[model samples]
Target: MTDFVEVDTAAGRVRGRWRPTTGTGRMPRSAAFLGIPFAEAPVGPLRFQAPVPKAPWEGVRDALEFAATAQRGDPGVTLIPEPSVPGESTLNVNVFTPDPDAAGLPVLVWIHGGGYFAGSPASAWYDGRNFNRDGVVTVSISYRLGFDGFGWIEDAPSNRGIRDWLLALEWVQQNIAAFGGDPSRVTIAGQSAGGGAVLTLLGMEKAQHLFHGVYAISGALADVSAERAEKFGRGLAAAGGVAPTVAGFSSLDEERVIALQKKATELGPSSLGSIVEEGLPLGPSVDGDLLVRPTRESLRAGVGADKPLVMGATDDEFTMAFSGVAKKLRWVPKAFLLNRLGMPKGAMRPYLAANQDALERGTAGIAGRLLTDRMFRTAVLNIAEDRGDAPTWLYRFSWPSGTFGFAEHCLDVPFFFDCLDGPAMVPLAGPNPPQALADQVHAAATSFIETGDPGWPVHEGDRGVVRVWDTPVSDVVDGYASVRALREPVS
Candidate 1:
């Protein structure tokens, strides 16, 4: 029993700590709450705009420390690392709890991936303490990455890091009910660009209702657009020698435009690389004021958030980013197999005649099943066959990491943040007792954040029931039919 509290938030009266652990066969009593801002501090004229509301503070503040970011590549440069813990209101939020009054529980939040450029939610594999001992509250957010979060500064304001994650889910819908949580039962998970920012905040419309459900691991909603994120912000303003106008690039030198975005991600897969499928040199777009469109045309016009969604991907999402540039590059295996299959000439031959033994793992298992079925199993089967009144759920972690290679790409994020016994979950899920697939993907992600039903069912089509996971718990079916027959569509 260790207590420390302070509420009244919306950006103030902060301070927190509240334990109750008493279940220490190893660890428990959760209820933590480190570093709680939510926005504000883009520094000097709110560099590149969008997230505003973080101003009120007047006392109590503490929040035990966890703030200071955004110099993390572009927007005045620096590429992550130099902040053992600096401060200046880095748009924070970190909560974990068992019962601050534990009302209606079920709130997840999360959202930390690094391809929008670098990561942090005070990373320690995102400590949400075994997801608040499984009753659930667990939040973790902190936006603004590269080019102060997804550069694209021409007329400015494109995915300002997906509008700082929709104002941190509108500050978890007006303050996650004083930390007991249940803001209408939210659930917005992430991984790998925070699983494509949880499928671009489930096709946001200001992330309607803040969030009702969604898991989106692995992430994809392809090539974001808004005129190709303003032509990748005019190629990141011609790699920082400016004049691409955000008023001639806000007086340049945000670490020399993130050291020219680490010299355009070391000039490898340019369009200013570091993954650019749907435009924008940084990430996230459609940008009619913070991603209000394109998530494959809002999941084929069904518009998002029908609710209860869960999603999956890993089965090698690009073998640890092409085994970290395969011994320092050389590529050209036919232009790295046609720019990693953006397709050309022989249109990759129906994905090479449906995997003729995946060309000897050269295309790292067909570029990890075409980057996990075009960025996450066809946008989770197009938001699970376009909402038949929601209830999506889909899986395919296909667990293959006895220390590297299948449960790849941010591997089920420390097995649903139970800290898969951290140390980076043994090169992705191995090295001594991961206690049965981290207690079954943290009990199916806390039983779908406590009762959205994650035991598996809704994914109708080819009867593929998925829940597979490891250490035994079957129900498989469509387990990569040659990566969903190379994601069909080739008429």
Candidate 2:
């Protein structure tokens, strides 16, 4: 344990220790600076608007420990991964580098995904060991989640969470030089909602020049529409027995607002509840400020970011999320299924026509795939199409996990980060681990970040080639037809 020294930041000097780990065959040296403040406390007056920069402190502040994270997946809410720990001042970023004084190493800034409701940068899966070893300084950031970040209140800023993310990037631009990272060669990457946020940032004018490349894994570029966000605000107000205005909302306790958010999730897509509404709501809104417009529109218009992009989704993207829902919905009576699914009373005939002996299994599988594909695979393809001018490296994570074949949603994080090769691989990939597959994916990602190529052809008009990442590398085209069909109507 090297003794921590005070490092000057835009916000004053903070102390951080350097911990050196044994270098792997490829990773010659690695050092991590645990918790560095990227932004000031998002408490008191700075609770709702865009994040304000931390004021320069008078003396050295400790940056040795990880700060508390935003609230995520409390017991009453859904079962998504929550922050291991929670608190108010969750706006912080952690950095890892091979050399603290190495002038201008390429930077890889990561944003974690937890449905925009859960997840934290502190998750073991997000550890930046591999990136640091590969000669790229890595940084992971934490932002607000759930109601604290996403809840809509009139006269208050919307998508405060995404704004928090932008603030972290701005912090990186200003301070990464001290840690030997090149602010000029920054690459932004994210998983799930983080991936979605990555795409959103790419299209925002204010976020231009902040990054030179992007890596989005299993994220939907097209977020909920603005009209839907207003409906969600109404729903939350109804749950709390208050109006949706900022004044009416500020009177309610944090717990009360959180309770309404939980209720919104439970009601789900059909009931116009919250984030998962049937239409569009509960996501980064086109609030005309933080999120200037929809991601699809922003990309199509070619607003600002023109950097190289590496974007992809897992093969079984929706299975993990849908499995939980299918377990409960499978038991519903067939007569009730029609009404619940919004199909006519005699709609079972078309269902039977489409699926013969395994109607239930087929329907569940199709629905699950469609859900994940629309939210991830299709949206990514749409982004690629609009980003025709930008160098694009497309991929499909196809290594089937023995535990959950084809590797369900969010499974690629550990693999690409090189964190799943050891003991932790079993729980996620099962007893008969696919080490060969893991190695292939890891190499492809590292290569893309280091160089410009990911060993796959760039996606062109009709030639939509994607890197089929598995035990061995191969090229495939337009394999996600079902997902394409589902989202074609909207696109």
Best-fitting candidate, scored by lDDT? 2
Q: Which structure among the candidates has the greatest TM-score?
A: 2
Error (Å) of candidate 1 at residue 165 is 12
In order of appearance, the predictions have TM-scores of 0.35, 0.86
> How many pairs of residues collide in each model?
14, 1
Per-model CA lDDT versus the true structure: 0.67, 0.69
Q: How displaced is residue 36 in candidate 2, in Å?
A: 2.1
Local accuracy of candidate 2 as per-residue lDDT tens digits, 150-230: 767777788888888888888999999988788998888988888888888888888887887888888754356677777
Off by over 4 Å in 2: 1-6, 20-27, 72-82, 267-280, 322-363, 421-425, 481-491
